[model samples]
Target: MSKSGYFVSFEGIDGSGKSTQARLLADHLRAMGRDVVLTREPGGSPGAEDIRKLVLEGDTDRWSPETELLLFTAARRDHLERTVNPALAAGQVVICDRFADSTRLYQGLARADLRGLVDQLHDLVIGQDPDLTVLIDMDPKIGLSRALARGDGEDRFESFGGDMQRRLRQGFLELAREFSERFVTIDGNRPVEDVFADMRDVVGARLP
Candidate 1:
């Protein structure tokens, strides 16, 4: 954790329950009397939220991998400036549903092996990362099922089908390895409470 404030980010394939876990952590912290700023990427700030609708609600082919890389990077910059930075600066715990790591895998490797460009853009703009990243690991098939069942218009990524989800899961695992110092893998195949419990434990040990 940084001296300014603890930064925790949750990541996983769609429907892996990462968002739910992030929310649970924030609630737990708040109940404990800690100020928490809970937010999500691609939509944390107003400008980023507007970008989110454009990128997530369109067809799978709505944008190329390069385009997505730019859009997501831009949104992340806005989010950091408007939502994440201030909270951390204020010594508040900032729990984010997703962060630039998502872009590293989703737009970086999963899309077209644009990982090089992804890293460059991230290093250039969004230089910071989560103090701790909780990755809810699960079978891609299971995640895809839950994601499709949601029927949310933001299913642009899920609409790619099971194969893509499997690849995404693999890529995320690889990411956890590459950035092992900050990534914690939690099994998300179990009950929601169980998953949240493990996540909380990991985060509790790390928070200042």
Candidate 2:
């Protein structure tokens, strides 16, 4: 499944700086004269963007856990086909803000028996996983506090209680353990520059 380009993903609870660090990695790679494509799951392609709104903004009262997982998979499928696979085919390093892991952490951990569904979707739709996944590990409380401080209105998942967030955090750590070879767990309590620097080093080692 190896390709000429690398696929890197950033994962973490809200406000753990996955998006910021993902952009930093992409910028750093581009500065090194590498072709880099920066994209995000749930909204990379136009069709996925439409699905994103449905997942984030639409009412959840009618949404079951399985349904939520399917919507995310649908968006991810569109994103992969439209942005990720093509960019990699052309030899571009692809750094994504979030991917299949988020669904596992947020939905699978939050909802009962949903992890299995997410896993099945990964096997059926995602097919190829990221070559490297930088997991920004942080306390759920700290992460949620930071998210609220940022003043962005709470999204569907962010609106959950502390216990749920704690479970999600644990889920991420568990995943990191289960996929140790592909996962790099970063201590996210450090300053943003330090975190980005650590990430840069990891990506640097993988470059040509």
Candidate 3:
């Protein structure tokens, strides 16, 4: 096993600009001559990508909360085994659009009672976490508008509406407080360049 690389995750409600920021960070690091692997979830590796479609498509109620968590955990396990771990072993910086934190917020916050289950499953199957998690915080209304504008086929979550997004935004902010050491909350309402500059500084300072 090798542990010579940096692992970073971008997290936020849908359309929070986290995905874009994640890509920008990867490009910036690569420009500086760093080995970087840019990926996303609920897909990253092949196996995970397959699982992603199952969970991200179809009706929002296609799977029960419990079943959804299982799919997500399985996907994450495969992602770590086939993608993230290998990248780390090869000494490459891994920048993921979303990681376990998304599960924690999306599923856990969906139903207050399921949070414990989410944490337990994570501990059992996905023990690893990103060294740095960049959370792009913004108003739910604005975020949802942006998310809907994208017209991404994966609207299962985006269709949850503004009220749900509000809950998610709050959940993410609370997570930031709980995981202060490894979490950085960036205001996503700002210009993309400003957000990227802040993200670059955050990741650059901690790059290994």
Candidate 4:
């Protein structure tokens, strides 16, 4: 499990621009001659990508929380084994758009109180956390609105509506506090350049 590379994950509500920021950071790192692998949860490796379709592009009631948790955990295990671990072992920076934290909020709190289950599954299977987690914090209403506007067929989570988003936003903040050692919160309501500037500065300070 020990690796020489840096592992960074971006976490936020559906449309908080975490994905965009993650990509930008990856590009910046690569431009600086750093070896970087940019990937996303539930869909990083081939097997995980297949699982992603089953979980992301369906009705809001596609699966029960417990079932969803199992599916996500399965996808993550594959993702970590095939994608993240290999990249880190090769001494490359692994930039993930969203990681275990998303599941902690979406399944653990948003749908029901499953944090304890989430942790148990994570420790039992995943057994890892990112070296740095950049939380793109933003207003839930705005994030959901932007997410729904994407028309990307990944709106199953956004379909839960504003209330769930509000709860998720608060949940993310609490998580930031809970894992303050590696969690860095950056406001996502600002312009792309402004937000990216902060993100770049934060990561640059921590990069090995």
lDDT agreement of model 4 with the native: 0.95
Clashes of each: 0, 0, 0, 0
Question: What is the overall TM-score of model 4 with all chains considered together?
Answer: 0.99
Candidate 2: 10-residue stretch with minimal lDDT: 151-160
User: What TM-score do all the candidates reach, one by one?
Assistant: 0.97, 0.93, 0.97, 0.99
Q: After superposition, how far is residue 57 of candidate 1 from its true place, in Å?
A: 0.7
Q: RMSD in Å for candidate 3, one decimal?
A: 1.0
lDDT of 4 by residue, 1-208 (tens): 9899999999998899999999999999999999999999879999999999999989988799999999999999999999999999999999999999999999998898998999999999999999999999999989998999999898888998999989999999999999999999999999999999999999999998
Top lDDT: which candidate number?
A: 4
Point out where model 3 deviates above 4 Å: none
lDDT of 2 by residue, 1-208 (tens): 4567789999988878888899988888888788999999779999999888777753445477778888989999989888998888888899998898889877776766678878887998788789899999888888888876875433666666577778877888999999998899888888999998998898788665
> What's the lDDT for residue 101 in model 2?
87
Query: Could you tell me how far off, in angstroms, the CA of residue 153 lies in candidate 1 after the best superposition?
Result: 0.9
lDDT tens per residue, model 1, 8-103: 999999999888888899899999999999999888999999999989987899999999999999999999989999899899999999898899
Query: Candidate 3: minimum summed lDDT over ten consecutive residues — where?
Result: 105-114
What is the TM-score (0 to 1) of candidate 1? 0.97
Error of 4 at 75 (Å): 0.3
Using TM-score as the measure, which candidate wins?
A: 4
